[model samples]
Target chain A: MSLKVENLSFSYGPRKALDDLSFALAPGSFTALLGPNGAGKSTLFSLLTRLFTAPKGQITIAGHDLGQAPLKALAALGVVFQQPTLDLDLTTRRNLLYYAALHGLRGPAARGLADEALATLSLTDRADTPARNLSGGQRRRVELARALIHRPAVLLLDEPSVGLDAASRRAITDHAHRLADRGTTVLWATHLTDEVGPTDRCLILHRGRLLADAPAGQIAEGTTLTDRFLALTAETA
Target chain B: MTPDPLHLSPNIPQGGPGGGARPPGPAAGRYLTALGAILHRELARFLGQKSRLVAALVRPLVWLLVFAAGFRAALGLSITPPYQTYITYETYILPGLLGMICLFNGMQSSLSLVYDREMGSMRLLLTAPLPRGWLLFAKLLAGTLISLLQCLVFLGIGYAWGIRPPLAGLLAVIPALLLTGLMLGALGLLLSSLIRQLENFAGVMNFVIFPMFFLSSALYPLWKMAEASPALARACALNPFTQAVELIRFSLYLTPNWPALGWTCLATAIFAAAALYGYDPARGFTRAKG
Candidate 1:
C-alpha cells in the first residue's frame, strides 16, 4: 500500500467528524473520494495530510507511519489544499521553485525540475506570469505542477476543481488521471461524480462513514453515478 | 517523446508496502536549504511591500520627531547609568524608539502570520519536511532580520535628527538590537498562534502593544514610573519590553546591562517554546479551522 488509513476516528470537541474510517491505496492507482458537503471528506483530507492528528487511528504513507515518522511520510506525499495556497504576488515558476526549496531541492537542480514540471503541465508559457495574472484554471494547473516538483509518491488534491469552469475542470481531472496512469498514487476528493471515471476506485462517504468502496462502475450498481450517489447519501440527508 | 513528469523509473525507489524508499532523513544540508528558502521568501515579501516598510517607520518617527519634541521639557531626566551627561529628551528616548521599531515590527510579522494561516500559505510552510521548531525559529529569525533593517534605518534617521551615540556605542548596539528583535519576534510568534483571525489582530495591537509599550521603560524610566505609582512601577519592571529597551539603552552607551540581557534571553526562550507548543498539531490552534 502506498497510503493506508486504519480505523481512523476524529472529533471536533463533542461532535465526531470522522468515524472509524479505513482505506488503503496501492501505488499507481487513482481513487476518487466522493462525498457530499459536510460528509467528513475535508476532515478525512485533514487527517490524511496531518493538518489535524487523528485521535484514534494509524495513517501510513509510503511505508512511513505519519505519527512515528511525519517528516518521511510528508516527504513522500504531495497535497493541494481546498483553499488557494499560491502566493499571488509570485510568478508561477517562482512559486514552484519555492516549493522545491521547501523539499530540499535548489539551485540548478530545482530550476531544471521546475522547468520539466511546468513543461509537463503545459504551463511553460505562463511560467513567468504572476499567479494573480493567471486565470483560475492556470493557477490550478500551476498548483498541480508545484505538487509534482518533488515527485511525491502519493498525491492528494482536495476539491481541486472547485470554482473552475467545465472545460478547466475536465482538463484538470484528465491530468490527474494521466498522473495516476504514470504511477503516482492519487486520491482526488470531490463532491462531483463526473470527476470519477468508470474504472477508477471510488469511496463514497456519508456522515463520517464509508458507504461504499469499490470500482466506480460497481459502486453505481445498475444506475448512473449521479443516481447512485444521491441514493446513497439521500438516506442520511 | 518526452517522458511524463509523473512517471517513476524502475531505478527510483518505490515507497510501497515495505519498500526501501527511505526519505532523505534529516540531512543537515536539507535543513539549511529549507531555512534559507524560508528566509529568502520572507525577505522577498518584505522587499516587495514598500507600504509595510513605511508603516513600520511612521510610528517611531512620529514618537521621535513630534512626541519627543513636545514632551522634552515636561519630562525632566536624572543622570542614568547609560547617560554620563545631561541629554535632550529626544536623545533619552532614542533607544526607546528603536525598541518601538522592533516591537511594532514583531506584531506586524505576527499579523502577517495570521493572514497567511487564513490564506493557506502557512500550510505550505508547516508541511515542509523539517523539524517544526527549526521552521518556527527560521520564521522568527526572518522577522528579526527585517526588524534589524528597520532599526538601522531608524538609527540613520535619528542621526539626522541630531541624536548621536558614540560610534563604538552604535556598533555595540547591534547585538543588543538583534537579541531584542528575536525576543519581541518570538512574542509575536506566540501571539500569532493564539490569534485565530486577522480581524482579531487589531484587538491584540490595542490590548498587547499599547499595554506593553505604555507599561514598559520605552516612554519613561522605571524610576519615573515608580515615583508615580509603585504598583505600576513593578509592572513596568516586569515587562520584557522594559528589559529590551534597557538593553538597547545600555548598549547605546557601550555599557553592558547583564540583568536586561538575561531577562530578554529568558523571555525569548519561553516565548519560542510556547509558540512551538501552540503550533503543535495535538494541542494548538493549528488544529482549528483556518
Candidate 2:
C-alpha cells in the first residue's frame, strides 16, 4: 500500500473529529476523498501528515509506520495543505528551493530539480516572481511543483481547488490525475463530485465516518456522483 | 506484495527529503543543509521588510537620542564594575538599550511565528523530514542572527553618538549578545507556542514586554530601583532580562559576569525545553488547531 490507515480515531476535547477511519491506497491509483465541510477531511490529512497524531490508530506510508518512523514515513509523502503554504514574499524558485532543502535536497542538485519542476508546470518564466505576484492559479501550480520536487511516492492534496477559478481548478485536477497515471499514489480531497472520474476509487466521509468505499461509478450506480453523494450525506446528516 | 511499484522515473529517486541521494537519516550534513535553508529564508524575509528594519533601528535610536537626553541630568552613574569612571547617563544606559533591541526582536519573531501558523507556512515547516526540536532550534538560531544584526547597527549608531566601547570590548560583546539573544528568543518561542492567535499575542506583549522591561535594569540600575523599593529591586535582580543586560554591560567592557552568564544560560535552557515540549506533535500542535 502506498498509504494506509487503520482504526484512526481522534477527538478535540469532548468533540470527536474522526472515528475509526480505515483505508489503503494502492500504488499508481488515484483516489478522491469526497466529503462535505467539517467532515474531518482536514483532520484525517493532519493525521496522515503527522501534524496531528491520534492515540487510537496506525498509519503507514510507503511501508514505514508513521508513529515508529516519522522521518521515513514523511519522506515518502507530499502534501499541499487546504490553505496556501507559500511564503508570499519569496520568489517561486526560492520557495521551491527552500522546500527542497527541507527535504535534504540541496546545492546544484536542488536547484536543478527546482528548475525542472517549474519547467514541468510551465512556470519557468515566472521562476523569479515572488509568490505574492502570481495569480492564485499560478501559486497553486507552483505549490504542486514544489510538492513533486522530491518525487514523493504518495501525494495528498486537501481541497486544492478551493478558491480557484474553474479553469485553474480543472487544470490542477488534471495535473493530479496525470501524476497518478505515472505511478504516484494520489489522494485528492474535495467536496466537488465533478472532480471525481467515473473509474476512480472514491471514499465518502461524513461526520468523521466513512460512508462509502468503491469505484466512483459503482458507488453512484444509476445516478450521478453528485446525486449519490447528496443522498448518502443527507441520509446520515 | 511487490516491494515497490511507483518507479515512474529512472532518473529521479522515489524517496523524498530523507531518501535517495540524501543521507540515510538526519545526518549532520542534512541537518546543516536544512539549517542553512531555514536561515536563508529568515534573512530573505527580514530583508524584504524595509519597514521592519527601520522600526528595529528607530526604536533604539529614539531611546538613545530623545529619552537619554531628557534623563541625562536626572540619572547619574558612579563607577561600576564595567564602568572605568563616572560615566554619563547615556553611556550607562547603552547596554540596557542594546538589550532592548534583542528583547523586541525576539518578541517580533514570535509574532511572525503566530502569523506563520495562521497563514499555514508553519505547517509546511513542521512537516519537514527533520526533527521538530532541530527545526525549532534552527528557527531560534535564525532569529538570533537577525537580532545580532540589528544590535550591530544600533552599536554603530551609538559610536556616532559618542558612546564608544573599546574595540576589544566590542569584539567580546558579540558572544554575550548571541547568548542573550538566544535566551530571549527562546522565551519568545515559548510564548508563541502558548499563545495561538495573533490577537492574543498583543495582550501578551503588553503583559510580558512591559513587566520584563520595567522590572529589569533595562532603563534604570537595580540599585536605583532598590532605593525606591527593595522588593522591586529583587524582582529586577531575578529577571532574566536583567541578567542579559548585565552580561551585555560587562562584556562591553571586557569583564565577564559569571552569575549573569549562568542565569541567562539556565533561562535559555528552561524556555527552550518548554517550547520544544509545547510544540511536540503529540502535545501542543495536536491540541491547537493548525
Candidate 3:
C-alpha cells in the first residue's frame, strides 16, 4: 500500500471535521476524492500531509507509521495544498531547488531533479523566470513540479486547479494522472465531477464521512456521476 | 522520458541519499539541506523587501535622532558601571535602541509567519520531512542575522554622529547581540503561534512591543524608574527585556553582566520551547477546520 489512513479523526473546537475516516490506496493508482464544500476534503489532506495531527488514528505511508516515525513517513510523501504556496518573488528554478532541499535533495543532485521536473512540465524555458511572471496555469504546474522534486511514493493534492482556466485545469489534471501512471500513488480532492475519469477509483466524502469507495463508474450506478453524487449527498443530508 | 526507471527514488550515491525508492530516515545531510534551504529563502525574502530594511532602520533611527535628542536635556546621566563618565542622552539610549531593533525585527519575523500561514506557504513548510523545531530555529536565526546587520549599521551611524563605543567593544558585543536577538526572535515565534489571524497582530504590537520597550531600561534607567516609583522599578528590573538591554549595554562597554546573561539565556530557552510547543500539531494549535 502506498497510503493507509485508519480511524483518522480531527476537531476544530466543538465542530468535528474528519470523523474516523479510513481508506487505503495501492501504488500506481489515480484516486479522486469527491466531496462538496465543507465535506472535509481539505481536512483529510491536511492530516495526510501532517499539517494537523489526527488525534485518534494511525497513518502509514509506504510502510512507515506517521505517528511512530514522522520523518521517514513524511519523506515518502509529497503534497500540493488547495491554496497557492509559491514564493512569487523567487524564480521557478529557485523555488524548486528550495523544495528539493526541504526534502533532503541538494547540490548538483537537487539541481538535476529540479531540471528534470521542469522539463517534464515543459517549463524548462520558464525555469529562470520569477513565479509572479508565470500564468496561473504555469504557476500551478510549477507547484506540481516542486512536489515531484523529491520523487515521493505517494502524492496528495487538495483542489490543485482551483483558479485556473479550463485549459490549464485540464493540463493540471492530465499531469496528475500522468504522475499516477509513473507509479506514484495520487490522491486528488475536488468537488468537480468533470475531473473524475470513468476508470479512476473514487472516494466520496460528505460532511466528515466517507459515504462511498469504489471506481467512478461504479459510484454512479445507472445515472451520471453528477446526479449520483447529488442524490447520495442529498440523501445523507 | 525519464532517466531512472524508478519513479519514487532517483539514483543517489552512498554518501548522498541512501536509496531513492524509500530513502532511509532523513539523514544528517538532508537535515542540513533543509536548514540551508530555509535560511536561503529567508535571506532572499529579506533582501527582496527593501521597504522592510528601511522600516527597521527608520524606527530606531527616529529614536536616536528625534526622541533621544528631545529627551537629552530632560534626562541626566550619572557615572554608572557601564559608563566611565556622564554620557550624552543619545549615547545612553544607543544600546536601548539596539534592543528595540531586535525586538521589532523579531516581531516582524512573527508577522511574516502569520503572513505565510495565510498564504499557504507555511503549510508547505509544515509538510517538510524535517523536524518543526529545526525549521523554526532556522527562521529565528535568519531574522536574528538581519537584525544584527541592521544593528551594526545603526552602531556605525551612531559612531559617525559622535556617539562611539570602544573599538574592542565592537567584537565583544557580537555574542551579546546574538543572544538578545535570539531571545526576542523566539518570543516573537511564540506569539505567532497564538495569533491565528493577521488582523490581530496590530493589537499584539500595542499590547506586547510597546509594553516591553517601555517597561524595560530602553529609554530610562531602572534606578530612574525606582526614583519615580519603587513598584514600577521592580517590574522593570524583573522584565526579561530589561535584562536583555542591560546585557547589551554592558557588553558594548566591555563588561559582562552574569545575572543579565543568565536571565536572557533562560528567557531564550523558555520562549524557544514555548514556540516549538505551539507549533506542535498533537498538543498545540495548527489544526484547521475543513
Best by lDDT: 2
Indicate the worst ten consecutive residues by lDDT in candidate 3 chain B: B10-19
Compared with the true structure, all predictions reach lDDT values of 0.86, 0.87, 0.86
User: Which pairs of residues clash in candidate 3, taking residues 3 or more apart in a chain or in different chains?
Assistant: B9-B20
| Local accuracy of candidate 1 as per-residue lDDT tens digits, B1-290 | 33333321223222231212222445887888888988999999998999989888998999999999999989999988889988899998899989988988899889989998888888888887777888888899999999999999999999988999998988999999999999989999999999988889889878999999999998998899999999999999999999999999999999989999999999999998899888887776766682
TM-scores for every predicted model: 0.95, 0.95, 0.95
lDDT at B213 for candidate 2? 87
The TM-score, computed over Cα atoms with residue i paired to residue i, of candidate 2 is: 0.95
Interface RMSD (Å), every candidate: 6.0, 7.4, 7.0
RMSD each, Å: 3.4, 4.2, 3.9
lDDT of 2 by residue, B119-237 (tens): 88998998888899999999999999999999998899999989999989888999999998999899889889988788898786689988998899988888889999999999999
What lDDT would candidate 1 get against the real structure?
0.86
Question: Which pairs of residues have clashing backbones in candidate 2?
Answer: A103-B17
Model 2 chain B weakest 10-residue run by lDDT: B1-10
Q: What is the lDDT of residue A216 in candidate 1?
A: 92
lDDT of 2 by residue, A62-177 (tens): 89999999988888888998889998888999999999989888878889888888877878889999999998778888888888888788999999888887666766777777
Q: Which residue runs does candidate 3 get wrong by more than 4 Å?
A: B1-26
TM-score of chain A of each: 0.98, 0.98, 0.98
- Write down the C-alpha DockQ for each prediction: 0.37, 0.35, 0.41
B118-138 per-residue lDDT for model 3 (tens digits): 889988888888898888888
